[model samples]
Structure formats: C-alpha cells, structure tokens
Target: MRKLSLLFSISFFSLYSFSQSGTMQYSGGKSADKAAVLIVPFEPFMYISEIDRQVGLENNLDGKAVKSEFAKALDLYLYQTFNEQFQVLSFYFMEDDVEQDLTYVYRSRKLEYEVLPEESTPKAEEKLKGIQTKLSKTFKKEEDESAYGGQIVTERDEKNKFMNAIISDQKVVDSLNNRYNASLYLLINQLEFRNVYGDFTQMEGNTYDRIAKVHYTLYSRRGTVVSKGLATTPFPASDNNLESITSTYFPILAEQIFNAVNMDITSTKN
Candidate 1:
C-alpha cells in the first residue's frame, strides 16, 4: 500500500510540473515554463500641466526624449516584473525591419500607428445623418456640438482600435507569430501624465499629486485578447528630469501594470 502511495505521489508531481510549464507552443515546440510574450514598441502621449510645460521649456526638454526614456524604462521594468511570471519577452518595431535581442522585430507594411480625431469625425457625421433621417427635415442644425467633436479619444480607445485593426489583418499577425513563436502579444499603446492637483493652469507647487496612465493590450497568438486596460499609478510631480522619472516612477508603474496583467491571466484561467 505504501509503495502504491509513493508511486501516486511521483505521478502527481510529474503531472504538476508538466502543467506548470507553459501549455502554449513556444520557440518551435520547446517547453517553456513561462509564456513567451512579444511586445510592440511603446507609443507615448503627453498632456502636461501649463506649469510643467513651462518647466519643460525652461529646461529645454522635449516630448520625444521623455517618451523615449519612458519607453525604455517601462520596457525594462516590464521584463523584470513579468520575468517572475514568465520568460521569453521580445520587442517588435513596426517601422524597423531589423531584429533586436532586447526583451521586446520586423514589419512588412508601414502603419501610421495613430488615430487622428479627424479620422473618427466621419463616423460621427454618419451617426448624425442617421438621427436626422429619423427626424423631420425642419430640424435645424443649431451648430451641432458633435460636429465640433470635442470628445478626447483616450489611450484605452486608441489601444482597442489599434489591436482590432492588427487582429483583423491576418498577414501582420501571421508574420509576427512565424518570427517570434510567441503566444502572447503586448502593445504599450500610450502613456499619459496628468496633474491631479487642481487646474493645470493654476497649479504652482514644486511637487503635486500626479497620475501616470499606461494603456496596454495583451492578445494571444490567434488575436484573442487576454487583457486590455489602462494601468494608473500616482506619484509626486517633479521636474522632467529623464533619470529622475525613470528611476523613481517607472518601477511603480511597472508594478501596477504587472498586477493588472497577472490578475487578468488568473481570471481568464478560472
């Protein structure tokens, strides 16, 4: 009886280990304990307070540099954080054909990678037309606010649209899968830093409560969405020092995003 119990224990342990290893196909059928994830290049969008903007101007700071630094920092922290949960992360740049060894590729077609407000204005017009059809011709257009379309498309919306477009395009999806052999694809769509303390124009403190919003989408090899949302972290606002922002704020943002991804994965499994 004891011998039979020992045999059963061994069998259970082996099965557990096998199950713990990644179930998805990775790196040409090699067994991976963690899911292989492919990350798209980071796209950043900044809407800083007037005070911060002035600070940036005084310091000769530009959005491009800040965006690039944040991208690298987030990429590094993401790998470090996700490494605890999985391994095999890589990056893919849509405009660049050269492949890099970094923990995040080539692209066939050039993508604008942005959705301008003008592009979505036509859809609003169509909707208005439909409503007009339901009403009488006498419905005078009183300078429709929708025609102005002040709706700010948030990062979350942008990510959704971008992911949907990519998923529908079979060629892009297939090409990535062939090259990366990764089942999970993550795109860091946009990052935003907002001043949470009073009006943007009136804020005059050296440090104020600020929130960092990171929008992302995680999809499967078949384009099935695993997780999609914005991860936000609050920090004390400071100067636009690249090193300061990276070292102080990025890890916090990374941790928040990591928790979000991990939660989603667990929820999906359940």
Candidate 2:
C-alpha cells in the first residue's frame, strides 16, 4: 500500500509539473531558424498628418510610450510565432550607437500633397492659396488637385533625409563591420499615413469613420532593398478611443513588419 501510494503521488506531481511548464506551441507559418537573430530596435519615423502627430504633440506622449507599447505587442506576437524555433535577441540601438554602426539607411521624399475640398471655384481658390503657402513651406506640390476629398496627390520633399543619410554613411558601415559583426541591415522608408473620413445616415443616427494607410520599404545591410510592404487599417475616432485602437492595430502592424522581414530573410537564404 505504501509503495502504491508513493507511486500515485509521484505521477500526480509529474503531471502537474508538465502542465505548468508554460511552453507555447507554434503551428502557424514555417518555423524560424534556430540561429540567434539580433533584432535592432525598430526605428520610428514620422507620418505627415494632424491626427498622427497629435498622439505625441498634444497628448504629452513621448517616444518611450510608443516604443513600450510596440515592444510589448511585438514581443508577445514573436514569442507565439517564433519562440519554438528561433532565439531572439534585443538589439537596442541608441542614436549614437546606430550612428556608429549603421550601414544602410532608408529615406523618403514625399511626392504628393492634397487638401480635401477642391480649390476650383474663386472662393476655394483663395482658400487654397493660403493653404498652399503654408504647405509649400513644408511640403512640395506634386500635381494639381483633381477631386475634393478622395483624390490622390503627389509631392516631393525631404522630411528626415539628413538623419537617414547619416545612418547609411560609410563611417557607420565600417563600424558595423568592426563592432556588431552584423552583415544585414533593414531600412523602412516612407511609412505613409493618410486619413479617410466618411459620413452616413442610417437608422442608428449618423456614422463617421476614419482610416489610416501605411506604406514602407525594407532594405538590406549592404544597401540592397529586400522587400516593400503596405498595410491599410481602419481607425475610427469615437469619443477619444484612439489609444485603444492604436494598441490593437499596432500588434497587427508589427506582425506585418515581421512578415516582411521573414520573407526577406527567406529570399536571401534561398
């Protein structure tokens, strides 16, 4: 009886331990390689928009807020998606650090700018002249306005060109070769955000919605572009619920970025 009781207790404990291991299983895409990957902290860039900038400008939110939220979401997704196969390392690069080792940088020159509400009529034309002056100081005009709200516009201007060039300088490349021993670098240029608004009359009173579109590019360490990916996600502004929406969508955005990187790595390996 004693021997049997001991055996049963041991079996129970073993089962409990197995259940508590907290191991995650990945059954989604192809597995990642087991080799260690140094993921440089994703550098954040600007998207020209009033709403996008307001998150930091008026809300008193800083870059750390954005970084923290992104890191949390990305860490969770990566763990679920790749933990079983690859060992991931955080490569946090400060401005100084990146300046010392960056090999290739990504820069975007805006090719379009359009204000909603056509500037065709005399009154509209006058309003546009003022808007154009302000815009010209900031953004270059690519083409004349066609439609009022949903028209496409193109413009050319340098927003963060200087910083990007410095990151891709020869000095940075030499440092990367000497210090981190990194062979590959990724650059995301031109992550664009466009605002879309709509109104509808329905049984439930009125409905309004806003959406955002993102465009980006990926480049290799040696200045070879690996891939380009774009994502358009909806962001509804209802009673200041922007933060919650941002939290939800950022994970999706991170996943899209990860997918781009994974594809590039696979292509290079093949």
Candidate 3:
C-alpha cells in the first residue's frame, strides 16, 4: 500500500511538471553563445475591462474562463514562432495579477448624413414646423430663449459616437520595469474595431466586412520608444468572437517583437 501511494504521487508530480514546462525553440538562428536574450512572456492586459462579460459574443462568459483560452492560444503561438531558437522564460504577468492605474480610449464615430445639401437660404416657417416636430420626437426638447423662440435639440445622434477613457501615467511604466526585471516593454496603444462598407461589384455576397486594427509600441528601459508596428485583419461578421479575432493577429505581433529584439541585440553587439 505504501509503495502504491508513493508511485501515484510521483506520477502526479511528473505530469504537473510536464504541463508547466512551456518553452519553445526556433531553429536557423545563429547558435546562442550566451543566454542574454530574456523574453518576458507577452502579458494580455488589454482584456481586463471585459472581465464581467463575454467579448464579442452573444453569450456572456466570465473573465476567468476566457483567460484559460487565451493562455492556450498564446502558448501555441509562441511555440510556433520560437520553436527552437528562443525559450519562453515564464508566464510573468496577467491582467488580474497586477494593479494598474491605466485608462483606455475607445472612440467610435458615424457620419449621420452626407454633406451634399447646399441651400444658401433658410427654408422659412412652413418647413420649419415639420422639422421641429421630427426633431422633438428624436431629441429631448429644451426651451432656450436664445434660439428662435426657445427651442433647442439635445439628444444622442442617430449614429452613435463616443470616445472612451485615456490612460497615461509614469507609474505604469515604472511598475512594469520593477516587476519584470525587463529593460524593455511593449504597449498596445490602439485597438479599433469597425464595419467597412464596400461595393459588391467585385463579387462578394455581402457589401460590408468587420475589421480590427492594432497599433503598438516598444519602449526601452529609458522610456524611449524603440519600434512600433500596426496590423489590420478582417473577420467574418457571422463569427463575432472577439477572442478569436484578436488571436488571429497575435502571430503577426509576436513575429514583429521577435524581429525587433533580434535587431536590437545585433545592433548592440556591433
């Protein structure tokens, strides 16, 4: 009985260790003479705000569930990219793991109408009466004596538009450096999602597509930006899974970071 218990414990520990070992190596790169290149794993801090609800999905899913999927996807991407040349050091930071005084801006704008009407003369009282009725229905009518008999239009636009929070602080940078022991850091500056309209003359069934655009920057220990990159990818409107859409661009981003690091290391040596 004692021997069986010991064997089971050893087996469980071995499996646990194997599961935890997340490293990848890339072939073809010059043999590493020194292990100076340390890659702090990519931390997904941008996904935190949506913790309570599902992102881009009709069904609501908690942040904890989404994180596991993200980890699996990220691990797969890193393994494919590095495959024998580089090693993934550790899963250092996650969105929920650290405290951040960060703010984000999400701007959305829609042109209400075409600016083609050029009428020099104001259409007088008759048309104005009908316009007033329509405006009243659409907007919360306010009485302001300044405008032609105290009428004012205050309402949300037919085309919804808004600019979200803006996050910027020196503390964020300092905290990142202190926690990771990394001299360089990466920041995801912009992530935009839009529906693009197009002419169907080219042969598509639908006249519009949903696209995602990402902009990011790399900063050195001195807070100097070393490099920046942008990527745009399209996703089918039917598949409104935000996680899936975002994961599509991860490889491109990982590659960009790898190339940037390679260049920096080479430049320093020279």
- Estimated TM-score for each candidate: 0.57, 0.45, 0.41
lDDT of 3 by residue, 238-260 (tens): 44353554456557545654565
Which residue pairs does candidate 1 place in steric collision? 90-104, 91-104
lDDT of 1 by residue, 141-249 (tens): 2243232111123322212122211345566667667766677877776565544444334256554455565656677788677876555555555655545655676
Error of 3 at 80 (Å): 6.8
| C-alpha lDDT score of every prediction, in listed order | 0.48, 0.37, 0.37
- Which residue runs does candidate 3 get wrong by more than 4 Å? 1-97, 100-175, 200-207, 241-249, 260-270
Candidate 1 residue-wise lDDT at 32: 49
lDDT of 2 at 184: 49
lDDT of 3 at 71: 43
